[model samples]
Target: MTSWVKFTVSIPDTHQDALVAQLSTAGFGGFVQEDDYIDCYVEKKKWTSGVQTRSREVLQRFAKEYPKLELRTETTDVEDRNWNAEWERSAGIVDATKKIVIKPSWKSLRRRDKGKIVLHIDPKMSFGTGHHETTRVCLRLMEYYVRRGDHVADFGTGTGVLAIAAAKLGASRVIAVDTDSWSFENASENVLRNKAGDRITVHKGSIVALGKRPFDLVVANIDLPTITKFLGRLLTLTRKGGVLILSGLLMTDLVPVLRLINRRSIIPLLLADEGEWIGFALQRT
Candidate 1:
């Protein structure tokens, strides 16, 4: 259980993407609940007076530019840093038709179904230790696209979970890429744990640095704007007739993202949901 500082802001819906991106880059995680408002969660050490000062400076800048926005700050008690809480809280068991099992590094494999494929992940803060709705959706989608001997790419590869899933699901080659150094480092350890070094190559960079390798499958479990920004490039990275799995979207947020994709004429073959989150599987024509 780790402590967190919650900063709330009310801004125009149009500015939400930029604000979230800014906050994320500033080391705060954004949780948006509305078009005009979002909550930013920052760790205690990162929430010093300097952070508050910077927040005010940023708010002032935004207000000067976008006068209708509002800024608010509040402090709340948070559980100690357990890092593995999600796994413990969720019990770390994911069930699906393909009999795939995602286990946390701390727990032993239990109650597994026959013929199940298991992938173990160490609990970490970056993402995709398999506890979030977005990761769940991506994992299921990966089961569909990844076939034996197919090359795969897990863009925004947090904790390397999706990349590991692709490898376990029978993809012969996997290229996992992430802009976050922590995530990339975590992915390296996971690649070794899965004994997939021969099949999975984890790299630190965005799709841009991964170059133009066309893959049989590409999975991106990042937010809507990032997805939209890279959708065309993602399609280009995916071979014709390959599959692309995308998640990390709210149900209400999917329309704009879909509209953007449709603008490029990339029709999705599947749309899925787990809880309030939504995901799509697109086939590159």
Candidate 2:
């Protein structure tokens, strides 16, 4: 039998996105978000002492940053059993847009969904199952901005859902980059599962790997801090007058992120919100 470590973090709703971002960067996977907290799980064999220390550090930092929230965390050891069934039970069909329906490989599509675009995704250790607000908003923005034959770059391409969507939406080519090797591998599997192997390229690296290359459209569904950290690189990788879709921000994070956008001289064309999460579409001048 296998064992897993589970970290349950309690935080104010406003700080959920930020905490998720921190936990993701710390190498935690398999997340379930609740109204007042988040549960993150990792295999015991993979959860090293360093990872545990890092997780504590993240909690400490967030607690200090949001003192009023009184953020807290608890840990437990879980005996692994039938994770696939659990994931299947938790993940249903996600209607990202009128034209886009995200369904797990295990789920059968209805007859009415025949003509609509379907993305078959098997959620593994990576993110972006199209169930999260950030991913849904990003897909909607992709539907609105992607043009036929356009080249796209999907930063932090967790599960490669956005990259696959860009390809299904008529993008000629897509470059999907993620820093996590697991996400890179998972996204690769999803791209092949979606039959986008010829159109989408998966790279295991951060935005720095993009270099000076520019794309017609760039979509990043990552947290605010990571977004801000790579803003300059993202701007440089987007062609002049190209579209940039950014998500994974809480409503409270908007003002500061918008200020940064203004400083870059990019003007946002649209602002979209779902629940507490927000996304933006900007045009590079």
Per-residue lDDT of candidate 1, residues 1-285 (tens digit): 557776778666666644553455455532433657766667777787877776776567556656666666555646455545533554466553356677766667675455688777774546665556677778777777688899998898878988888888888989999887768888899889889999989889989766787999889888776887888899899899999888887676777976877776566888989766788998888
Candidate 1 at residue 64, lDDT?
A: 69
Q: For each candidate, what is the lDDT?
A: 0.74, 0.87
Kindly provide the TM-score of model 1 when superposed on the true structure, using C-alpha atoms: 0.74
User: Which TM-score value belongs to model 2?
Assistant: 0.88
Point out where model 1 deviates above 4 Å.
1-26, 29-91, 96-98
Clashing pairs in 1: 1-79, 1-80, 1-81, 1-82, 2-79, 2-80, 2-81
Query: Over the stretch 1-285, how does candidate 2's per-residue lDDT look in tens digits?
Result: 989999899875666766776687677868777789888998898899888888888788777767778766788999987767878877989888888999998889988788999999888878888877888989888888999999999999999999999999999999999988878988999999999999999999988765568999999998887888889889889999999999988787888997998799698899888887899999999
